[model samples]
Target: MSAALRIGMDIGGSKTAAVALDDAGTVVAATELGTVRGDDGVVDTAESAIVALATQTGVAPSGFASVGIGIPGQVDRGLGVVRNAYNIGVARLPLAQRLSARTGLAVSLDNDVTAAAIGAAHLMRLSGTVAYLNLGTGLSAGFVVDGVPLRGAHGVAGEIGHLAVDPRERPCPCGQRGCLETVASGSALRTYWPAGGDHPGRVLLSAIAAGDAEARAAYDALVAGAASCVRLLVLALDPHTVVIGGGLRLLGAPLVDGIRGELDLAAATSPFLTELELSARVQVLPADSSAAAVGAALAGNL
Candidate 1:
């Protein structure tokens, strides 16, 4: 029999990325396209992207055993629907069913961060408990235990972005005050440095390098929120490793160092925190890795 081909797609607010992997999970093809809003537009865009990828790679979509998708929103995997994905402007959309009908392939759908964790774990060959903290346009986490993602009862187990780390009443889109995303995510940094241009993260980094006080403060807030996230995860799941991914990972050493410093400071205050060794357990994935797409594809196998 031909090796099973698994297709994975990561649907983001601005762009959509898709990849095809062989039975062994090696990427055989990949492509990207601009994301579209609305149910029909989104489905059409994904279908076109997948078809284009298959054509580019000289493989037919029907040849693939199944398709897996990672989307930025609350996904009801059991129902094969996206309950809400504000960034992509989707709500109550039957994403998996629509894609399956269009592509003639079985479909598996999951939250982007959750799929990313699966991909990261597969790529890193990580066993035991692992946490994937995504610091992207927004912030959230995905936990994988023994190769399976913990979806929780409501499938929101890792929605740590809205955990309300700050009490100063900073408004969040989720109708909350002081959500971690309000201070720590790419969106938060952009709000802090609104004039930072298109790539706010890079702009903020440059400003920090130039000793810009406001920029520094924003960065510090990000560090504190991120550190709190790790602390909470350590105390709750106590995962073997906390792998940091997403757009914010682009901040590179500065971001990692800041998080480490904050964790270290907290560790010094309490031996119990010190025992967690969060700094040592944290790992950063390369910014360019297609973890979400790869993981989405792997989701089909699961």
Candidate 2:
């Protein structure tokens, strides 16, 4: 018998990515497309990704046993309604039902981080507890203890991006001041950025390396911002290892060292830091990253 095939769709703020995997977890096909703006855009983009994957792989959408979606913004997976997707103005949209009707496949839906963490864990295929931090356009996290992503009491537990860090900083979409997103995200970098520049970490690190006092100052602030995040990670959610993903990770040592160095300075006695430092367990997001989309695709198996 031909093993069943599962289709996974990962929709983000600006693009849609999809993958088809056989029972063996081999990717049958992969495709990506641009965002379809507005409510109609959601359906258009989803249909496009679905059709592209189906057509390219010679796999009928109906032939798939399961389909999963990892979406930005709020989702009520129990009912398959996207409560409030800020990215594309998709509010209370019945995503699962809509897609299921179109593809004739059982659909699984979840937050992007939840999906990404799931995929990353599966890639590493680790046994113990693992946590994933997505440093995407914004910051978010998901935890998988023994291969299961914890959905929390309300199924919305890991909102690490919303962790408040600064007292005198800007507010967040969550109606709070000093959230981690305010300082550490690509969105935050736009505020103080010089136009036509490289990535924030690259520019900042360059400045520091070149002995630019301004760059040093910027680096100091970034380290402090990241320290605030690491400090909280130590106190609140102590995981075996923190997997850092997103464009910011391209900064490499500046990203890892800055966080660890500041964390050591602020949290002298943290077992979490001790464990990480001792084990060298910190892993950065690779240049060719696919964990998020893959995790979104595997949500049904979870």
Best by lDDT: 1
If scored against the real structure, what TM-score would every candidate get?
0.96, 0.86
Candidate 1 similarity to native, TM-score? 0.96
Expressed as tens digits, the lDDT of each residue in 1-302 for candidate 2 is 23277777788877788888878776778888988866678877887887887788777757767878888777778888776787777776888888778767788789888887887777766556667766666777788888778878766767877877677568787898888887777666655455316456546666667777655655566557766655565456666666776667777766777777676665467765565552244566565556767787778767
Point out where model 2 deviates above 4 Å.
1-3, 194-220, 267-279
TM-score of 2: 0.86
Q: What is the lDDT of residue 36 in candidate 2?
A: 84
Worst window of 10 by summed lDDT in candidate 1:
1-10
Error of 2 at 59 (Å): 1.3
